[model samples]
Target chain A: MSGNSEMSPRRPRLAVWKLASCDGCQLTLLDCEDELLAVAGAVDIAYFREATSAAVDGPYDLSLVEGSITTAADARRIREVRAATTTLVTIGACATAGGVQALRNLGDIDDFKKAVYARPEFISTLATSTPIRDHVPVDFELRGCPISKRQLLETLSAFLARRTPNVPTESVCLECKRRGNVCVLVAHGTPCLGPVTQAGCGAICPAFHRGCYGCFGPQDTVNAPPLLTELQQLGLSPPQLERLLRTFNAEAPAFRAAAESLGAGGEK
Target chain B: MTERTIAVDYLARVEGEGALRARLDGDRVEEVELRIFEPPRFFEALLRGRSFEEAPDLTARICGICPVAYQMSASHAMESALGMHVTGTLRELRRLLYCGEWIESHSLHIYLLHAPDFLGFPDAVRMAKEFPEVVARGLSLKRAGNHLMEVLGGREIHPVNVRVGGFYRAPEREELEALRPELEKALGLAAETVRFASGLEFPDVEEDYEFVSLVHPDEYPMNEGLIRSSRGLEIPAARYEEEFEELQVPHSNALHSVRRGGGSYLVGPMARYALNRTRLLPKTRALANDVGLEPVVTNPARSIIVRSLEVHYACEEALRILSTYRRPEAAFVPPPATFEGGSGAAATEAPRGLLYHRYELSRERLIERARIVAPTSQNQKRIEDDLRHLLERQIRADDATLTDACERAIRHHDPCISCATHFLTLEVDRR
Candidate 1:
């Protein structure tokens, strides 16, 4: 963990950046109430607008980027962010995948603008919301609609120590089993994406007696086709199955293809 | 003639991406635009065709700070549309959940976001160096709220437990009972917060705000109420569109909301406190009176006191609900097996202010159309008005001091820019 200490006498500078997002992922850092001051002691919180008004100019030692790139300006701005950091970690579904806003990717952008705004011309937006990895090379991707607080701290700790983060890429079903939660899919015959979704959220939905809605996006090796077939048999129609796959991580390659196979992707 | 411009390219200490620009010509403030460049995510546009059941979770993505507000508004709107009224233990649980959000969101603003402006510090971290106990108290208070949310809603941000009719699962009696001790501590912390906020030196400034909020006859509004404004405008949520309109301005991604005939109005802590002062819990009301906070807080900078008082009420309210909570028989009230298309609208008091949601559902229960009027969006125009008025008074101050003051004034309302586009560079020009 002390691998990078010899390189600089000063504590590492950490910068938190936002693109197009709900600010939830960045908030995950603040949500670490107990660990926040300790983390601050370990590093200089040079730039984090949501928590502080302070900004220290880069080249920062580590940068945690939240949200997706949804505008041309953001696309350009993200490049600058990448250039300013030695290690760049994308946090949450928005930064790792395209988030819920990526729903625009499968619909008509013009129609979307018109639907939400009376004067569409006044809005400056890209047709699609794409993740940070699409725009810049990311050192790590922490996935969740709002990234898990535990994983966020671990990621920060790992980066400070100059080590690889220990985030697993396993499906949420594994977590559910470890949690001793009854399989909602098998027991209650409820449709769930746990079998195909990532594990970071601790299988919270299933534990809550609700079916997983795949807020964490896809797992490492998703066999979504079989899962979709099972869900369809469980009474989810083709469109329902498509809508299920096309949520927070709609633009993720695997989920996008799954939605498209169900005849639900591209401009609506 | 000398020309000067004050501009803040990227605003800090507020949620989301935003900037401020105010242009002043000589002694007169020419233009003050609360430019909400937080790229429009098209939440309303994207919601179309999704199942009505998905509204709460989906709309909760609008702002991370106040997801509960969105969830409550969306769920209530959907429940209204489906003709399903959730009452009894379920209703109490929802209110309890909202109290958690209020406590969490308010504590965040009071400590991390707004406190720095008053202390002349860049951030809370710096403030914590000198006043560790103050910062610790705030964090502890915030944790109590987040813990309460985790027990009920599953996680703090974008909780998985909320559904249309009610929660996905009802928390056990023991689960709720466990939160009481923490909440008991939080109540004292909240009172301390109110006192601390009241002690801050506020700029001697006031605005003639047309305060608006949800007003329940029996209690301080959080979930259900008729929409009432300080200017004698009272209407049900169904008539929201008839009275107010969201107009598209050339400079902003967020549409500015205004009363149909009137111009800008305020909705938030000040608004809620102004319209529902009598409805607050006795302790919270007493705390306000003890602090010498006026019944109607027109000074936006003094909103900290109002927000802190609400936090006190929320903690008390949570403890009250926890004491009386009985686990509902069912996790959620099931929607009808068959559906007939209908439209419904509802407004809920978010920690920020009143959040309004309207949805038109198709026969199949798919959301045909959706409209969301976030509190910040409703307050955007009024915020600009505040800035304009502020610039008029501080026009003689230098660009740097004036800009700093402008940013502080904006922070007073604690605008969630992320929710507003749904929502600051300050430029002062002297010629």
Candidate 2:
């Protein structure tokens, strides 16, 4: 590792930038506590404002940007961030697809801001929050509300090694079955989003004896029709299933159709 | 004569987006700022139409590090407005889960994040290379806290079991009893953390500011207490807005809070430590005195030591609760969300500091309006004050000295930016 970092000719400075989402995706980096020392030894963090006061000049080799571009200014900020980096990888559902805050995209942004701030006029934000790809060309996207730490480290390692990261794009239901956990829908009649949601977070909810809530965004090429049918089978009226899909990963295509099928917008 | 700006564009090992900046004009320091530029999600606006029951889950997203505190505060407010007492094992279970949060969040901050700053390192990962044993010990302690939450709340991040009135489910006695060994191991690690923090190089900067935290007569405040400040101001949680008020500044979208009289007061570890020193677990109390941590004086800079002391207390508290943990006869009390008219506020001790929630529930059981004053928000003004004070110390020092001082200043408050990210532009004009 020392020889690799030294003989790599030039250390690619990495900058972590945030947009609009839960801080969880960025937190995954720190959450990799055990592997952090090893990871730092490999990469030269040129501009990670979340972690250090010191800055090394950055025309970064790689930029791992978290969150979605939500405001008009953030829409501008992404271009500046993209210009300074060679490879731009978006991490988390927020950056790849619009995050939970995208729920505001379906509603009124001015009405939303006014409800929260005493002086809503002071806030400068866009009517919609969209993924970084809408604003700039993204090299890669590691999906999930808070991207898994192991997956993050693996992505970093792959980027450094000049190889594609070994990330699975299968549905969480596949992993849930691989772990030999019983299907809650088959046995307990509990509706689950696992069949359509991405395979990450280790199928956390199912392991905890609850159905998946799809916090990790949707899986690749998801079959949403069957799941909506399952929700109906489990006694969820159309409105209930609509509310369920419109949570954290609301704006993803598969979830959007499921919500629309039930005849509703992204509100309770 | 030279004028220079010391800027830390990012702070490492801590949660959320934070940067520290200061300007030195020759031998005089012009301005200092602690800025939170984390991306904004506008949660307050989103919650306007969400169901009252959804508040716990929705607001929990505010901080991944301290979701439990948000859930607790929101739940209590909702329950109170619904005119109900969440009595029996459910109440005890809530306390136990809070203890888990205290253990996890405290250990994570005190050892992994804040300790390295005192020891002259770039981050915890750097510090860990020299202190492997300490890092390992801290992880297991942290793991124990997450484990406790997993068992009780369903998952560590945005736990599922908690609801407005009670949990959806409860763990059996055998499952609850299984955590004893983990708690035991955590206690050992906590003791080591005390020694480790005690060994760090603490700068000789102390302040005589006011310490504000929740205090309960029966215990070191966890779920409920009378809001108290070191300046001798005490009031019920219902009167929290009256005492501590948030002001919106034109420079930033985030609100800066202060005690009603005008002076900024601190929250989190130092505040909690001073206000509830006597109520600390026995072993933790002894360790505080052992480490030479005197609860006297409100030095925001020295709060790191106090944070370490509180970690000791949290570990001890976790162990106590785990050992005596009894599954209450009932997991939770039923909700009375149909109250005609009720207004209530709730305050809970988060891993960082006091988290306050106020709600006005209408007869229909939907929320008319809600106000959430997070611990990180209350501590913002205090953090800026620390920056201003620390800059005075490094007035004669170089850019590097001022930069480190700015780091130290922000570290004093241990700002969590996900909650405060809606606002900030820290400018230190040297001219």
Candidate 3:
């Protein structure tokens, strides 16, 4: 793709799309400060608003979609994005699950709107914030509140190689154990989601002497029931457990089920 | 009568989704709208019923570019509500974390997002093909900032370390000292950045701005200060709502903030530098003087220089904190066991400008209500005002030229539209 010969086919066109998100996942690409120019050389950045003003008409080779489908226009836009790209990869919790904003999914969205805006009537939003996969088929989902840079690079490299990305599906516990650190849950009696949460963030919270807050969402084979039980035994109140499950990946199936089973339901 | 329209379907090189529209009637400007189409996540609404301790992490999601600003503002507000003050090493650590953010965020803007316009490139990637060393310096400088954040806060983007009252864990002196060499290199690079930015040709134009920023007595404001403005308006964070009000407009999702019973005001690098010029470190102050940068820069286009100067200040500040580093006994000062249920407010200087957060907590420590006024929301109207003036001057320019100029002007403030309704597309209608 970096060939200089005129006979070489043009580089794969990469387009980045944002729906409703903090713009973190895409920033991860830019944050690859050392590798950004190389990535650019490997792919033609057809569209990326946060980094470049230039754009090219798309039938892009690959599209990395960030954020969630939170508005009617965004819902419509994602379809257009899917239609324009050959491969669509959803980045971050917002695109893979529904993200922290999905807390509104469990509540009365009208009330949610009124709580923030003085003229709630003026705001145009869907009742629920949902991941990109819910609206359109996502080729792959890279998970995190803000995804890990290493994982992001791996995913991009995988796309260029036409191979499956080597992101781990194991829980944070495995990563924590590999780091040779004492378990905060076992040693400190802290309520931790490391046992159920996905790995990618390098088990940061635990290393910092805190329990995992599950920013990477649920692991592939989560048995959240036992973890909740353990948390309860560790002195977490029922409301606290429910609240913890209803954070960054609030609407991820596993977490939502766990929170719902606690009877709080994340709803009024 | 001739009618023409310039419409930018999507605005690029900005943090989030937004568009712009301007209408011109003959030579007079009819309207300028800095449209923010980014879907509102209803952060303030969702924050209710969440634990007070969750504020820092949750609010950090507001903008990827300036998560530290949100974290700092939320943490400080929660601390104020609980009547807990983090002193000594912990306080210095917060400033240090902020310096890392400023360095990273400012470098991102100067080199990647904003510089392309001045250098006649589409983006930094293209610019890199020709000016590899320049872009490399920027990326290296950004890496230094990110490395500092990683060592201290655990990760750069949405750091997992910051908590109310203090940090989840304080890095050892060695962990911090490891950053000194890179920071030293970054300081030199940042100085080069100021010089590089100063060489850019700015339009000889100035705006009468009511510049607002945090003013600290001892240091350049980052984590704490009185909210002061160039117009002699000084108030605590608690009085932020009294002085400024967010008004919802039909064209955009982000609310436009203006001084109460007054018009639009400016914030960010220009505001901070103008308000706290003397408070900058001696080296940074000397650099600014050497570059012949005015004490009070009123031209929005010259903000790139101010932002570069801030990057220099942040580097120096980070080194200063590192030089005197000592790990606090506790990772955090735990909140009081019992709660009386109170409210608190705080304003911190985000790389862009002042970010204000207020929270009302229940006796059970759950958040009852929350309000976040992002810098871009405050600057949105002022940005439109700047656009209006720019359009007036370039009235005879073609649609594409006017549209390009408008986007450049908006970029001048480095508006984080994600933080604003928390934001561009451009439309110019000439009739």
Candidate 4:
């Protein structure tokens, strides 16, 4: 068996999609100010409305989807996007863990809508904002409120090279230790999610003298119950701890379960 | 007589999801809708009960393109409620940080999003193939802004350093010094950008825009000022709800803002420039005049020029702030020891337009309510009005051309619907 010699290989076609998001994750790709032009050269960039007006019909090689699926149109659109892409990677907390907006998933969406909009009847939305994986199969998940640009570049590089992306799934505590920053939780009595929150944001909140609010979702081996207990001991009440865990990557399984276990319930 | 509808299901290039629909009934434009389909994030609702300290981080999530706007408005509002203001160096640093956003956001719009439309490319990558130097300059200018943010606020996209009173930490003078050369280069590039933007082919369209912006007595408005309009209306930020009201229209999730009983108004660079042109630094003012920009420009398409002028001003301002840099004794001012509560409102000039945040805090300093009015929401009605005007003027153009031209008109506003739908998407239907 041999590869076809007559046809030349083409750059991988990349499509960036947004559903319900802050546009930060995709902006991360553009925020690669040094590498943006080079990255553009390596990919076809078939469809990315936020960055370009040029759109190509897709059967894309790789699709980086941002935002959670929160509307009826988006639900159908994700299926269409999935059908049109060979490998679909969901980027950011919204796409992977339902984002900050996912707080509505636990509450009455109507009340949420009414609270935000004066005439809620005019608004169209799903009852809950859910992750991309909830609607369609995702090949990979890149976590962050706005994903780390380095990780994003790596993920894109992996797609271009047809290699497995090397993204760590360790807790933020490990990252904090690696950076040699003193533990805000252990040393300063600050209630932090570093114990269970996934690494990637470089322990940013902790480095800033604040507790990690878990923008990167949960680590692979998250036992958030223990972290919640620890937080309670550090002066965070059950309600405060629940609100803390339920931000950014709020609906992640480990964090959600922990919040529920603390009697915060599914309805925030 | 063709009675047809032209619909754009999703607007490209502009930030966030939104659609535009225009219906023509036998050459008469019957209906024009700037449909903002960006899914609602319910930020105003979710902010309730959160600590007032968290407002900056939370509201910053509204728009990746202009997080500083949200952060500034939030911090200012919270500061007002707490009965404190970041004084001297702290205030200057906040202004410096805003200049970074102005540079970044404006450059992104001018080079990547809006420029491509004028240059007849699908996006900047394609445009770069033709105008590499221009694109590179824009990116460099944008990076300078990002570098400033990184040094001051930690990161560019969603800066984590900002709090209610000030930043978590301030940049060292040496750290700021390192950014000077790059910003100097950006200053030159921004000047060239003004010349380039002024040279773009603009449609012969102008509107009697009721421009609104914050105007500080002594400086260009960014963080603090009374909300003033071209219509001679002046109000404190607290009176924002009274002067301007949001209409819950069926076509968009984001409410359409109007001047109480009046019509649409313009904001952002054009508004800021038109209303506060006298306050611009000499170099920035020279660049604007060199480009033949009038003190009060009404052509919507020429907003690109205004943004370029702003980029020039921002770079200069950033440099001035950096050169006079004295790190504050403390990174942030602590709130008052007393536990009394109050409500406060603030309007800041986001790169795109005005961003207003009104917060009602409890005695315990928890946010009882949050009312955020992003610029895009305020500009939505105006955008539709512009489209309607465009259709009336170019009613006879081919469908493709009309759609392309309409998209261009919307781009002039550089509408960050993401800011609004939370803010946008575009659809055009002609029947």
Candidate 5:
């Protein structure tokens, strides 16, 4: 908890890992232009493949893991991450839920890959992209396509403090209502996932007068079925309801279950 | 003779995952492979069955730094698919947004990533220790660009405010005015950046390049322009596929692109500068000349100067857009779509290079086929060609020197391989 870089010599070594998602999440650390140098003061930066060539041996104090476990290699790699770090924080939707790419978990991944590649045999992957928690324990999970910058800063701050980061587990409605933004769904009759989706992103979509598409995944407790019923009453067909749930955080358990049940034949 | 490899296990000072492998046969320069091993996301595959509306969000995942490029290009292509023509204020806003991307992306590369190689620093953070003012200017310039993106697109990366037809929300007049002070300051920094880069000690490396870019009339190309190059090649954006082709290289998952019958070509800052130097506003063009960068020049090593000049141009253009800002009533106009009968292809000048996207949407509006040609891919063979010749010159230099030379050569273009398997691996071999 002390801010002494020299006196408290064990400057907790940090390592960043990536799996089946964009490198944006880890780049958030590098993109910390204002605090990058000071950040290096707090950590040995033992291994961050995205940033530097200087890497040290790690039974790291902190490991910031990005991306989801999509391939079998990633599934195996998460174990190595958990083994290497005392505190493992998974950042972004890919690491927490299966990410937007996890939409394949709803269908056949092999078929998906084959449809894209000329030689699908060359590709190696698992049929599903699952969250980091599915394979190994994650000390914390930061949610977003690339994770929020403030959240990342807080998470790093917490690790340095040896306390849980102050990430709210509430719904997007709270952030939206706090921002005093008009409800896109309530006022404009837009079918939004804000009611079921988690906070963070400052309820960004709704603040801009657009309904939430839930880039931040589900809240700690979401009644997705009830939300689906609301969407249905607002004139969503069964497939329309399914498509709504099966986006961004499609592999998150509640949304995943909601997608399957809603996508079924004419679920009127 | 013993074989020595100057290997950078993970490529730094570049965008995305890549490695370089240089084979040395007693300094004869056997082969140099810029291996791009970044995992593929199958964006083109995921795009299928997706509404043309989803293209921006889906394809934006291809690269983080150049997400705006992906979004703009995808939006333009899909808009074309719908037989929509956007112009006036809406079109100007798109160009202004692109100017922001160019300034941010170019300054980041020219200062933080590419400049260090020339300045003999490991990275910009280290370079700041010696040249704090320069690095500060660079960050400020980059911040100005991010501010523009935030004001317009919402977030700097994979901005959510963008939709197929237009923005989910349009910036108000005050939002555009808020950017003016920062932009005016950015203009000064951009000029200083050119002076800094143009004065950098460049290792002598130049090659014959088929320079490619989007050329426009009365404006430096950004969002809307015809694809053209210094080699007298001209094609409408719609003919990008017919003019250029992509082929899978053995060492990469991303395909290399070239002129249909030609060997290799250059894109990105250097190429854009050489091809469209005249189109730049008076001040930026003057900066190019004052910095000893004449369009007729053939020095690839001096590409840094070109990128810096672009930083100047982008800053100036952004300020112009801001000063003349009138908040449009609508962010986008819904254009009509006539499917099957019409095929649309368009290329935009992404910060990296000319990003081309073409689609054959069937009558049912399902994507029948998709073609994407990233700037990194277009520059691949040209990079290898540069490596072969540049390393040959440094054949007598020590392994470290020669290897660094090769890395510098590849980084000169600021390649982003994520768009290709996606961008750089640094390997140096000497005998």
Candidate 6:
């Protein structure tokens, strides 16, 4: 299990980097309260700014990057981060897709700036929020608005053990059935993305009697056109369906295409 | 005259990114700037023209550490705008949900983020090596809180169940009952935490600062209250804009919140403790007494103690509510007919402090205007002010020592900068 890390006398150096998004995905590591100390014991947290003040000079063994490349400064900073790591893993929807803030990807950045700030001239932002892969190569991508804690642990464990992580690429419907949850879509006529959405969140929305909001982005083999047609039947207007697809994982290609096909721009 | 520069290019151990710079001539501190470089996501701008129903989930994305605060504040504001009120057991359930967030967020700040600074550790991971049991206790307590959130709201981060009127579906009686044993265990752990925190060596520093928070008449404030401050200022949540103003500075994307008549004031656990000590539940009050925490805590670093006490209160309150929880006949109240073309404002006690959300709804139930003032943004000026005070006192110290002290000082507010540049940089120049 300790194959790769054991090659060196020192522990594998791990660094976590942030770009522009909610700190949720990075927080998932901290939320590993039970396993955090153990994870630390297993590796060196060389540069995790949000969790520690101590930073070790990097040519890091593994890097976990969060957030998306939103600002020009971040665009350069991510390149620097890429140069310093052996293996890079993008965590959360923001890193994997463009995240919710990427809602800007489909609309006017200038108008967005003016709406949010009094002096839009002071703000410097990219026209669109883009994922890490758009700018740099990523060895792996862990998905979710905030990636599921169990999946996060598995990813970390696989890295520490020097093995490829066994992550499911199946749809959320499989998870819903596994959990014995009644399908909210079938029973209540609620529009749900569960059929095409990824499974990492364990069908949580259906358990709560709410339709899946697709926080995990899209399933690998998604045929979202059918899901959109079903949602239309279940009373989701084209605009409403578009808004649903463009939430946390807003700029993910599959979801983005689905929403675009519906004639709705990403902006609210 | 001599000049030297002490710079921390990146401020660490806080949520999000920010920078701090201070300039001094000899030992006289000249300028202090808490620069927030966390990229602005433009949440307030994005909320414009969206359905009011989207507010809870969309705003919850603002800060992952305190999603409940955003959700509760958004829900309450929308509910008020619709002229629909959730009361009785449903109201209690919402408070219970908030209590869960309080326990989770406070435990995280106190143990994982803030405590390592108090001790001589760079992070909690290092701290755990020396005091594994204490760290484990904190983690378990935090997990218990997350468990409650998972059961009620569907997931800890950006819970899916919370809607404007109420939850999408209320938890079954057994679902709540299942949390009892864990809460009981957490109660004991929280008690131990309060005692453990009380014994920690606190830095002997106090600043004369104004403390502000929401104060409920009958209960410790959570979802509802009147905005009050230690400086004899009291106003309804609707009057927040009337009392305070947001100033735009070139260095920060967040607007610095300053009172109309006064300057910067504190809003967080310290503020809540100072303003609502009399309103604390009985068990929490006794623990505060045992811990020797004064009603007015002036030391920012010692705010960890206040956070622990709040955790105790949250655990106790959650238990108190769960025991009598009866799954409501209907999960939520349907919105009233008066839901069109109205304005609503609400002040809820975020774990950090008072979070205010104001929304103007169009007749179509679309959000025409939205303004959200996160607690961290409100406390930015106060944080900078505290840094200046600390810098003046320790102006003669060496660069490394002084920079470390200043970083610890910023951590005192448990500043969620992600909530504020949308907020740290630490740099010191001495002459």
Preferred candidate (DockQ higher): 2 or 5: 2
> lDDT of all predictions, in order shown?
0.89, 0.75, 0.91, 0.87, 0.76, 0.88
DockQ for model 4 equals 0.73
At residue B293, candidate 1 shows an lDDT of: 87
Higher-lDDT candidate of 4 and 6: 6
lDDT of 2 by residue, B83-150 (tens): 77886667778888988888777777776667667777776656778977766777777778878887
Q: Would you list the clashing residue pairs of candidate 2?
A: A49-B10, A50-B11, A51-B11, A51-B12, A52-B10, A52-B11, A52-B12, B207-B299
DockQ winner, 1 or 3 = 1
For each candidate, report its DockQ versus the true two-chain complex.
0.82, 0.45, 0.81, 0.73, 0.42, 0.78
Candidate 6 overall lDDT versus native: 0.88
lDDT of 4 by residue, B1-431 (tens): 48777777788888998888888877789998888888899998888878888889888988888999999999999888889878899999999999999999999999988888788888898899999998998889889988888778777989888888887777778988999899999999999999999899887887989999999888989988989999898899989999899888887888889998899998888899888999999999877777778999899989989999999999999999888997677989999999788899989999988899999999989888899999999998998899898888888887888888888888889988899887333344555
For residue B400, give model 6's deviation from the true position in Å: 1.5
True contacts kept of 5: 0.26
Candidate 6, TM-score vs. the true structure?
0.98
Tens-digit lDDT string for candidate 4 (A184-264): 888988778888988998887777777777889889998876677777877777777777877887789988888878885
**lDDT tens per residue, model 5, B10-112:** 6766676788887776768877888876666666655565556667877787777878888888888877877888778777788888888888778777777
How would you encode candidate 6's per-residue C-alpha lDDT over B8-107 as one tens digit per residue? 6788888888888888889888888888888888887778778889999999989999999999999999988888889988899999999999999999
Number of clashes in every candidate structure?
17, 8, 12, 29, 14, 12
- Give the winner by TM-score: 1 or 5: 1
Instruction: Give candidate 4's whole-model lDDT.
Output: 0.87
Give the CA lDDT, 0 to 100, for residue B119 in model 3: 88
TM-score of 5: 0.94
Badly placed stretches (over 4 Å) of model 3 are: A1-8, A265-268
lDDT of 5 at B43: 60
